[model samples]
Target: MADNDNRDHNRRDRDDRRRNADGGRPRSGGSGQRGYGADRGGNERRDWGSKERRGEGGDRRSYGDRDSRGGDRQDRRRDDRRSSGDRDNRRGDSRGDSRDNRGGRRPTGARYGQRGDDFTGGPRSGPVRQGFREERMDRRAAEPDLPEGLDLADLDPLVRQDLRVLSKDNAEAVGKHILMAAELVDDAPELALQHARAAKNRAGRVAVAREVNGITAYRAGEWKEALSELRAARRIGGGPGMLALMADCERGLGRPEKAIELSRSEEVAQLDREAAVEFAIVIAGARHDMGQHESAVLTVERMNPDRKDDSFSGLRLAYAYADALAQAGRTEEARDWFAHVVAKDEDEWTDAAERLEALD
Candidate 1:
């Protein structure tokens, strides 16, 4: 009885080892899990080597199957469709050569699946197409022509070089308008402003074009426009030239306080001799505009106007001093300074001769 009992126990142990709770032998692979397929009872699991079990009726999709198989199938289908269409286009064939050849349908007839416009085999009409073309032509014709006075050949070589940022053809066209603007600035300043605007529209990024626009606007007394363009030019390329003009524009707009503030900025201190003289003149004018005539005279007097130098800046400095004195009610001293200005006014660039005669 004892030997029979031991043999029975050993047989029971072998049975447990060969069969699991689900009634199948352990798999031979890693972790000895079950197969990927499901049984009729919907209790099957995969050999993913993890303890996690799927919920009841959970799908049997695996991560590797979805990524490697599904992704590659999708990519290959897309490539095949593209390559087939490209081959059809290269062959220039309309018949059975098409990727989706629908019984050799002709390419030029009613779009394969859609109805033609009039059943006469023509493109469908939407908005009046000709009307758009006509409107575009009218817009082109209505645009203002570049001024006839524009002549790039007349500009100095250095001046022309400033437009090198633009293409050669664009530079020449914009350069012409700039030259025309300069030519008309004195006699017809408003027209000069128009020319300058044309150049700026063509090459708005060019510093020289912006400078011309600002200067022309200043000449035309368009104070707001001058200030904006000059400020833009200065931001693009820092130079001391625009400071005085910008300050004067401030005075033009009845902002003498702002003008004074700008004149005293650090940039004004670094100005070259010509810009410095112009800055002084504008500052003095701003003081006068604020009804501080004595202060204006004092500002100009600080320049120490010497009668010896006949440079343009020297002449302008002297003239500003004389004007400041006249405006300050010091007529005798004003006349003496004006006389000094007239002696150097050979070209008569300023109205110094007329100013002295008026003082007399």
Candidate 2:
């Protein structure tokens, strides 16, 4: 019984082992866990290659995926490096190029662009445009150091004409500087003489010096000195007013006969109507001063009645004529002449009020 039992158990165990060997199901504990394709040994011997081949086949797919991934990573890294390096280069270039350009600022218009050497399309005068630009910059930079209220003296005639402001070419500007000097001497006679002397020392034939000296001598009560200057002024070819003034000085020195002689000279007769009128008035004043009242009235009557001049020479004669009439006790006629003086003195005849009051 024991032997039979042993035999049955051994047979049953063998059958169970055979069924397990032919079942075609994977092991439960480690299902499908294989190195590459090693499970199909001889039946698919082409698939069951060496560990190196199997590993290569499996590793080829893994290597292909890894290689593709590695290639993408490498490309990304290259792009990052390229973008970073490019960005850095751009930033450095921007910083480096800013210092060279200043007022004439442009991105591409400087050396090799639109302003290609500044000598391409037209002929470039050497250093002219650049020098002018540099000079303007230098002038603007130096503006604070320039003197106040001082204008740059212009020598350019075309620019001066275009602006039409004040022309330095006319030389009136030179007189403007001395205008105050002339006015300062108007009241101070001694200083005026010194100023005239200094001006004469600078250049001969200075009309300004002659005028100032003559006027100062007249003011200082130097009658003979005044006459000397007046004569000198005439000899030096003074203005027409100076001739009138010379006659006046003669009258002032109590030389009525000499004044009459000078006024009625052949030279005086040859002058224009204006000058003749002035001379006639001077003669009338001198005659009146000499107490020749009738002669003074007749002197004005001898003048042509039509002409006029800015000196109002006729007005002076009219006043003197009224005075002479008053002196002669012709009261009614003197009043009429004084009234006429007031009526006709629209040009502001000197001593108009005094002449009118004499008539009243």
Candidate 3:
């Protein structure tokens, strides 16, 4: 009887060890107790082992089994942790797992089989969010209202020729907007910009419309927008008429070096006399902006300030030369040039009178 009891006891010990090695519950009738995966409160704990060893309806997998299933162990662990609400509550989601509930990762478009527009990790709150908001607002902004008595005939004939590519109604509307922009540019630059924007919205592909919009934007001190529209105009029209304005816009934006570089471009040679003179003035202004006053004076000298022409370019050249002379500390010469500009500027286009008074 004692020998038989010893044999039975040794056999039960072997069974307990074998159950522990298999990560299963030990023999309940023996001194060994249940292990981690044992059933508790009628709920069977998940078995992290091979599917072949798991009972029916068991979907959990161990590290080695997960490796054969074609995924890293860490990914499997993350999925297991997420599925167990108790585990997630006990230990917060791991940062290494990007798909956690805290919203730290970009959407995996393939997971949902649909693309998402929100590329940012979380709710965007900085410049990126502001940019999207502004874009939406721009798309929803109300169109500018046309003023009474405005007509397509008021637009310049050259500009009207470019609008022919648009539909008749759209061409007329764009032309009217351009005319309003031109008329209001000197007095109400903001209103002019509205009209210009209206024209661009209606006839964006037309070079003349873009040119007018750029000019109005320049008048309104929108240096960056002015530069962009002017570049678009240049590309579409293949004209150098607005090169001076574009360079001046660079000066307005505090990019004097870019203004100078633009002035030196080969396209400057293609500009008409007035446009060339305007470009030269822009170069001189850029030189002044860089504190190269003496160089600015030299730039203006190349335009022949001694010429007696009383045209618009002549007045602009004289005013710029006088300003350069003033900046260079040639006070007497500057005073003389300013007086000349004041005499020839019959339309009071320049502030030469004020400058001359200040010099005196």
Q: Residue by residue across 132-204, what tens digits does model 3's lDDT show? A: 7776457436657777887677666767767776667878888888888988899999999998998887777
**Which residue pairs show collisions in model 3?**
none
Write down the RMSD of candidate 3 (Cα, Å): 23.0
Q: State the C-alpha lDDT per candidate.
A: 0.72, 0.51, 0.74
Highest TM-score: give the candidate number. Answer: 3
Model 3 Cα shift for residue 314 (angstroms): 1.0
| TM-score per candidate, chains pooled | 0.58, 0.43, 0.59
- Give me the candidate number with maximum lDDT: 3
lDDT of 1 by residue, 150-207 (tens): 5677887756766664667878878877877887899989888888988877777666
Which window of 10 residues has the lowest lDDT sum in candidate 3? 117-126
Name the lDDT value of residue 21 in candidate 3.
Answer: 53
TM-score, model 1 to reference: 0.58
Clashing pairs in 2: none
Summarize candidate 2's per-residue lDDT along 294-353 as a digit string, tens digits: 887777777744324324666666666666677777888777766666677876655656
